[model samples]
Target: MTEQKRYAILPLIAIGLVGGLLSGLFGIGGGVIIVPALVLLLVMPQRLAAGTSVAAILPAAVVGAISYAVQGNVDWTAGILLAVGIVIGSQVGALLLSKLPVGFLQWLFLGFLLVVIVSLWFVVPQRDSEISITVLTGAMLAVTGFLTGILSGLIGVGGGIIVVPVLMFFFGANDLVAKGTSLVMMIPGSLSGTLANWRRKNVDLRAAAAVGLAASAASPLGTIIAGTLAPSMSNILFSIFLVLIFTQMLVRLIRAKKN
Candidate 1:
């Protein structure tokens, strides 16, 4: 590679490493970190940055999911139910995106996050023995996943941000289990999105490789830390994460309005 190209690769890897840590720690796809870092640090265009972020997310999801699964935190049936809903919801969401006003969607997403924060603080269920899934529980998970997928498609954010809270607060899952299940639910969605981006030639293969590999290496460490946190502490961390994501969306919306 040229000297300039070589220099560029290091920062991508660094961004991916940090993003992956956050992903494993929080059961996210790390697009929150990857997209902004690519735009600001690598001077990538927003569209391409988003596409590349999707590509990088796939490996991070896989690595993180495996770590969570190894700990017996993943609920496979729940994850599958959520994934099924995501597939349906995402198709509808993509169809709707072009017709919706960006500002409106941004406000809506912010509102959703606020509601989630309230639920996390006030409505989160007290810890008890792990709940076994029934038909109703599976249905609830599917509905929550569908809603999360719609928002993810419309806003270009990872569905995990929505999935984790719903799993915990609405479905009565413990924090670690919720996060792990969210990671499992994200795998197929991320892969599908990334593959579509690749087909469109939107993904930069070299950059994606550097980011994905770095994320894979760092994910286990983050998962380890997450596994060790208390349930209440994990909920606190997740609420803070939601607020941060909400603020970012608000800022981006304001910027778009200006231009």
Candidate 2:
């Protein structure tokens, strides 16, 4: 008898559960987990994995964002402004994904995470500070969103990692509010990116659905947990999470190079 393997949903579900939990707790789109898992565990191509991951983030982001909104942590004006820029930027990124060398993306991802982790230790956000919506600030927020969206499309991220830190560190927003608003910004960003990926035949709907449903189901639990943690502790834990991911990817890259 010959042993053969085909598609299975179990791994996808397992990946989704972990990804969703972290997404809610850290206010990220879970692409950090999904993209690598798809590429390493499922033997997916990097570009395709990124595209599928973006598609999956849509549903999970919606669920997580609503949970945060229920706690009154979301900023509608700031989020909307960010979304407008993200909508246009996602298309630009999606276009770039096909043209740019995939190796460059790995470096970009690793570098950005390092910068964010370092930035977190120096910044402590107050829970009471909210976004002061001035015209200049709004324009800055939109520009921030546009740049983040481009990276999101290229990397299959939901933009929360960058957005959350930028909101808390630069905008003087509360940690929770930054998280909630980042989730909200991801909704349109993911949708727009997913559409572009779909047109490029980069997305696999079956895989996306499997991962997304599992992630959405688990997301609220993470949101509930996030509310119980202190902002300082949350930043510490998030930094640890990023470190682990960074290490994992580095190890994988080393192994790939050795092969």
- Estimate TM-scores for all models: 0.86, 0.93
**TM-score of predicted model 2?**
0.93
TM-score winner among the candidates? 2
Query: Stretches of candidate 2 above 4 Å error?
Result: 1-6, 253-259
Q: What is the Cα root-mean-square deviation between model 1 and the actual structure?
A: 3.5
What number of clashing residue pairs does each candidate have, in the order they appear? 0, 0
How well does candidate 2 score on lDDT at residue 201? 78
Instruction: Mark the regions of model 1 whose C-alpha exceeds 4 Å error after superposition.
Output: 1-7, 91-101, 123-132
Q: After superposition, how far is residue 1 of candidate 2 from its true place, in Å?
A: 30
Candidate 1 C-alpha lDDT tens digits along 43-101: 87655676677668778889999999998888899999998887666555544554565
Distance from true position, residue 252, model 2, in Å? 4.0
